[model samples]
Target: MTQIDIKVASSEILEKYFIGNELPLEAPVETWINYEREEKGMDVKMKSFCHLLFYSKLGSQLFDSINLDLDGSCCLIGTTILTAVRIAVDPLTEVVYSENPDRNFLKSNNFSYGIVVVGELPYSESVGDSTNLTIAEPGYDTITNVCEYVKCVVIIMSGRPVVIEPYLPKMEALVAAWLPGTEGQGVSDVLFGDYGFTGKLARTWFKTVDQLPMNVGDPHYDPLFPFGYGLTTIPIERKATQ
Candidate 1:
């Protein structure tokens, strides 16, 4: 988390004065082309912001038990949880109940209102157009197992939506923080309830890749989540300003 913090902060400074917005030092198109060609940037800042939002099966139950309200609380976030890290142990177990003391700290407070933010870091250059829509190995059961014993907020960091049907039944809350650009504080900003969750889903999340090609004339059009699928901390109808 600290590493993420540092990277994000620095990226914002760069973005403010150089990359995206109105800044005098902003690079020109020719310079931009060269920069892209070289792929020059920080990985943490490059990451799009995507975190778990709303709640799944464990929704009301979780909000009631732990203080995981739109309000805020301490939480844990895991990364790159695809394959099993230990040959003798389940990969999901490695992440959920790993030897990591931080995980243990949150688990200890499970019944007492502990909050663990956990999920996978799935990425690809282009969304649907590119292949590799799979959620990988043990990632399928990560939320189910973790939520069984701990109060957790799941985050899926990806450039595009991936299948989430299986784990939906157990997840309390999930956020889709697309590669959050170097503003790590935004993660804490939302987690701590400093600000309300205002982002929405940009793509459809399917139950499985088998239901792919979610386009016109595609026979299998059933999606776990459809396009424009999104939720906000404040109801759209009641927001101060829509």
Candidate 2:
């Protein structure tokens, strides 16, 4: 039954939180800024982002004020810090907003369902025809958050061999998503629990790069994280009591 106290700010950071806004919003900008300035010590030139955050909280509270049965699922944690971190640390949301929604406004169109990919599968250095270890351009081989909001992890490794034993404890899943040409969406379909995570790591991962020239397939190569080794998911469970 308690109301959530709202703080205000001014920044372009709205893009930093929610995405898919193209047409001018109905909320009066000056009214929000003035009220925020007088009561919350808000920045004078209130930015669109601050405006968006303020309105978002205000909108949520307004619904709760009407006693719309907001109990567990609707309760957002307090503080600007939490909001900032959620919008920052989440890879999925970043990917969604990065889709240039303003240009390709999803709302204005007919489709309602949305999807965002936030993880990256590791890819070996790509090769031209020669495969002579020539320098390569950053190919379109990685997952780019293209308008759908989803928190994702990506593995980006340079050509140098790695000693991955220590860091494996912190990781949830691994995918040797070797460098595929222009199939980000297709690969993402597989990794994001979409097409079923069924790819195999193409090479071997040794605890130490020293294991190189020690292939298991042919007298010496081994991998610490063999291909097709990572998966991530959100756990759906009953909320703990306050």
Candidate 3:
């Protein structure tokens, strides 16, 4: 989350000075790029203000929970999750509960209300096109159709750009929605708004472990989707319908 904080601050700097500041940065996701410290595991260079807004909302939730507990009954929790914002996340855990008939199977389809049992803390876009992704899955030809349905092209590799040479004709815009952390809502926010998608896969999505990119200290440790790519959303006119 702190990484996001830095990105937020840097974005402010980017905004106040870059692109004349008077006008919104044009195609920011691609115009500007900043990848957070890899160790932190978050691309702090947020392409949209929506991410900033979401983090602010999280802060409000934290303050209310703690301020209302002013009875001194609550002690600030400091652990893996340093802040309530960190705790109240959308973690997708793939755990199977102990055998119990009460539950039909291992997991249920309902979402979890995210628990913030105890924690403290604080916290806290673009567009483009270019698709025609390739897919080499022989039997999964339908994936090609799926790509076309969504107007995807230039299939970004989840794992080594899936030898799409044979199926490139089916795509329009392809990207690797990396295994980002819990706050996936941030991902959705960027994808659906004024900001363009600028994220790339942090890790290689390999079909087999043997094909995984090795960290051999080579300068060209290439990724399927080379670090920066984004697009701007098309402006739309609102019309009242009868």
RMSD per prediction, one decimal? Answer: 16.3, 19.6, 18.7
**Each prediction's TM-score versus the true structure:** 0.46, 0.31, 0.26
Whichever of 1 and 2 has more lDDT, that candidate is 1
Arrange candidates by lDDT, highest first: which order? 1, 2, 3
Report the lDDT tens digits of candidate 3 across residue range 185-219: 44434433323454544434323334345443447
Q: Which sections of candidate 1 miss by over 4 Å?
A: 1-132, 136-138, 216-220, 235-242
True-vs-predicted CA distance for residue 233, candidate 2, Å: 12
> Over 4 Å off in model 2, which ranges?
1-152, 156-163, 217-223, 226-242
lDDT per residue for candidate 1 within 1-242, as digits (tens), equals 11221122212332342233422222221111011111235332223232323222211101111112121222223312221112212234433334233434445653522233344344445433545564544554555556666665666655667666666666677777666643344565565454678776566677777666675346766777666777767533445565
Deviation in angstroms for 75 in model 2? Answer: 48
Global lDDT of model 3: 0.31
lDDT against the true structure, each candidate: 0.44, 0.34, 0.31
lDDT of 2 by residue, 1-242 (tens): 23222333333433322343422323422212212122245333222222222344223211111111122123222332122323323345442333223324543554323332222234544632222221132212223221232223434323432443543443444344443333244444444433455444445555764555445565554566654445444322212221
Candidate 2 shows a clash count of 22
Report how far off residue 6 is in candidate 3 (Å): 38
